[model samples]
Target: MGKPMVLFLCTGNSARSQMAEAFLRQHAGNKYDAHSAGLNPQGVHPLTIQVMKETGIDISGHQSKSLNQYLGKTSPKWVIFGCEKAEESCPHVWPFSLQSESWNLEDPVDFTGDELEQLMKFRFVRDQIEARILDWITENRIDSETEN
Candidate 1:
């Protein structure tokens, strides 16, 4: 059988959800198939690529996808909303029978600051997602070979 799937959702497929997807894949790619999508698909943010690169994970090839894409497809093992908007707006009856949860992370794109400050915010958000992924891996005993 193929690896179990984990889906991350957010307002835009640009930041938080993207970061979480990348972090999970890097840490537990061998154990789970990580994917991400948005309520309103906005392309992946450039800062996301930069911040992920800092952690040695390249999300540059990741694309913005809408939640509808997975509507009639395979059900993920876990569907995690990375932002409140996604959690609240998600459909009551999804096609999948997966477990769902919310992360309630602040949107880094909503941060208003200078270039350097904005970059720092992105990095902070990226680190936060990575930390959460690591915690989840340990708690679930994923047996990930990647070093955090």
Candidate 2:
């Protein structure tokens, strides 16, 4: 069987969800496939690319996509919303999803600050997403191993 799939969603696919997708791919790509989309597609943010690059993961090529891209084509094992807007906007029932959750992560785009401070905010969110992904990977490791 193929690895399980994880989809991260947010209002804009520019930051939080993007970061989560890359982190999951980096931390558990062998055990799961990580993908992300937006309720309203906004091109990946420049700061998002910069912050991720700081961690050595280049998401410069990652495109912000609409959830429609996956609605009928893919059924993720987990559908995770990175923000409250997405959680509220998405359908309550993902018929094919095994689980659904909202992370309610802070949107770095909403943070108002100088360049360095803004970058710090982006990094902060990025790190938070990474930590959560790591914990999730650990929590699911046993299940993933058994399934494989």
Candidate 3:
């Protein structure tokens, strides 16, 4: 059997979902296939690229995708919503998903501030997502090379 698929869904594929996907792939690529999409499909934010780069994960090539892309094609074992809005918008019965849940991370795109502050907000959200990914990996006992 192939690695289980994990999908991160959010209002915009711009930040939170993007971060979660990359972190999971980096931390536990051996255990799961990570993918992400958004309800609205906003293009990935510039800050999202910049922040992920800070962690040595280059998401510059990642594109924002719509939920429709996966609706009929893939079966994700786990579907995680990065924000409340996406969770609320998601259908109660997600097809082929064994588990579904929300993380409710703040949308850094919604944070208002100057350039530096805006970057900081993105970094903060990125860190939060990474931490959650690490925790989830540990809780599930996913033994990846990086965890050794």
The lDDT per prediction is 0.84, 0.91, 0.89
lDDT of 1 by residue, 42-76 (tens): 99999999989988988788999999888778678
Residue lDDT tens for model 2, 15-111: 9999999999988899998999999998999999999999999999999999989887988889999988898887663777988887899999999
Candidate 3: give the clashing pairs.
Answer: none
Please, what is the TM-score per model?
0.91, 0.96, 0.93
Which candidate number maximizes TM-score? Answer: 2
Ranking by lDDT: 2, 3, 1
Superposition TM-score, candidate 2 onto the true structure: 0.96
> What is the clash count of model 2?
0
Positional deviation of residue 80's Cα in model 1 after best superposition, in angstroms: 0.4
Minimum summed lDDT over a 10-residue window in model 1 is located at: 139-148
Residue ranges of candidate 1 with Cα displaced over 4 Å = 91-96, 142-148
Ranking by TM-score: 2, 3, 1
